[model samples]
Target: MPFFLRTMMKVLRVPKRTIFIVVIAFVLGSASIAYAIEPTTFHTWFNALYWVMTTMATVGYGDYFAKTVRGKIFTLFIYVFGIGLLSLVIGKIIDLLSTVYKHWEAGKLNFHGKDHIILINWSKKAQYAIEEILSFSPSSHIVVIDESDKHPVTDRQEIHFISGDPSSEEILEKAMLKQAKAVIIFADTRIDEPALADGKTLLIASSIERLHPAIHTTVEITQEKNTKNFRHVHVNDFVLSYDAVSRLAVRAALQQGSSEIINQLIRREVGDDIYEIPVRPEWKTYKDAFQGALEYGATLLSDRGDLGINRKLNDPIPEDARLFVVSDEQTYRRLLAI
Candidate 1:
């Protein structure tokens, strides 16, 4: 090796002894050899590097050639060794990408971002929840935790998957539960018994509470009677999945089109869905806020989960108030701007 080539390799940090480093050293050394032997044919340093690149890439443009016997021998050596080393590097890169993609699809990677919604368990209800969340906030990041071998939803970029036992703290940490906006746990319907499914959900919810007590967690249970069991855990909310369906069915039969109305309210894509809005600076009382929303074509529903805002119209609005309203997306946008 030339003194300058050795010095250049040292400056380039080629002493790491990695395959990539070795490949870089080989290419640079080959370029220097080509330039030193045939300075007339390869007039510039860039031409020597370009010739090495074309030969290693198998492009063989044939613009540069070896005129001497020694140059031809060196060219034959490159054809045998240089091309093989470049091919090895290319194959390694392809393999690395394939492994990363496989790990991602298999839910083996960790989510490093914050404020993402963490979903526990995969089911039809979870699928609908993801759809509804996306309808409301299309840019929302969702991290799904399930015990499946592969990701349930692969087509969407906003949704990520982590495969493991939901009750495992390691798995929750992998999903970045500490920085999550909220967590939704669905009953694993694959289990034969409803009690077993609820038990799984409860265990996962308890784990979440232990890991992050302040993280708002909503759980779905198959049986309404089992709600008492979760009283110990500080779960934010619970949904009786089967009981809700049965109640909705009875309501639909009793008060025609009631289920449709409820469905429309729950779904963001449907007309007049529920939305939360911040209090405007000019609003002083419930009446002021209510009338302001009415002017913007929105109906005031409640303030901070208090549904009796209609009766409390004369009362002053609380300082830490969160108002809920019913309006279309366009009307909500207009209300937000005001």
Candidate 2:
């Protein structure tokens, strides 16, 4: 039993070695056993190998036959021992594949996805975020990595997983970090301490930035205090979950239906969503942009760019200026053209 367990472990751990051993054993065992009957049944080593392969595979072609009494006795042992060993080796391969699959599902395997979205850190938030993205684009490739023992999301073959610290370059590389369309790093909300959780998220964002400086990244910050710290990483966007919730809670306590209204605004099923578009040719001037927003039924939120924000709307909109507008998907697209 102990020897069997050790062999199983070796086969599972080092399948290449097990395959080499099995192939070598099959050649030597078949050559020794079948060569004895070669003089009667098979004329040469090549014919002996053909007979052994066919017989062991249980495809008994009648082209070869044992003529002598000694050959017949040896044939009995060949059928029993050769077929049994070959079956055991084939069974080992199947078992190894199953074991590898389980490991892969558990996120022990390296990632191979490209042009996919990567979600760093596992949490209820991560799961929801992934689901939200997939709801709109179900075919979008997504890879999730976390330090947790087991993946929170499963039964999703489309969602590849890497179970490890996201800050590790080795682990990040497995997810095809450089080739990813975008990465969203969520604070590990499982950790009781909010600071520690946000800190980890910050580190993961910085690590991703270092891995590929131009890779677009979005990170969820759980602590209001750490908001400024993430700016150093040059993250493209921040979720600011803790601060947003706290402000919403304060508004709800002071006013009527504030929380419900805020929730409705951000909810996926809500009437409208926030979208951003670059300033258009007709909307080059601030007054034109402002009038265009009103004409198109889009609520103009802000005019911004990578290096600066122009909330005043008094000056002319620059060529690189982007406008944040709140409107339905259909209206938003029309507003961009108008």
Best of the candidates, TM-score: 1
Q: Mind giving the per-residue lDDT tens digits that candidate 1 earns over 223-259?
A: 8888988877978889988788898999999999999
Give me the overall lDDT of model 2: 0.78
Q: Give the poorly placed runs of model 2, Cα more than 4 Å off.
A: 1-86, 253-258, 277-283, 286-301, 304-316, 330-338
In the range 1-338, model 2's lDDT, one tens digit per residue, is: 99999976765565556665876677666766677655655767778778777777789888986667777776777788677667767777788799888887788887776789999887788888887788657899999998876756678888888888899999999899988999998878678888898888888888999999888899888776787899888999888887787788899999978888677667656667777866777665676766777788887767654223335556777666677877787887786665
Question: TM per model?
Answer: 0.89, 0.69
- In model 2, which residue pairs have backbone atoms overlapping below 3 Å? none
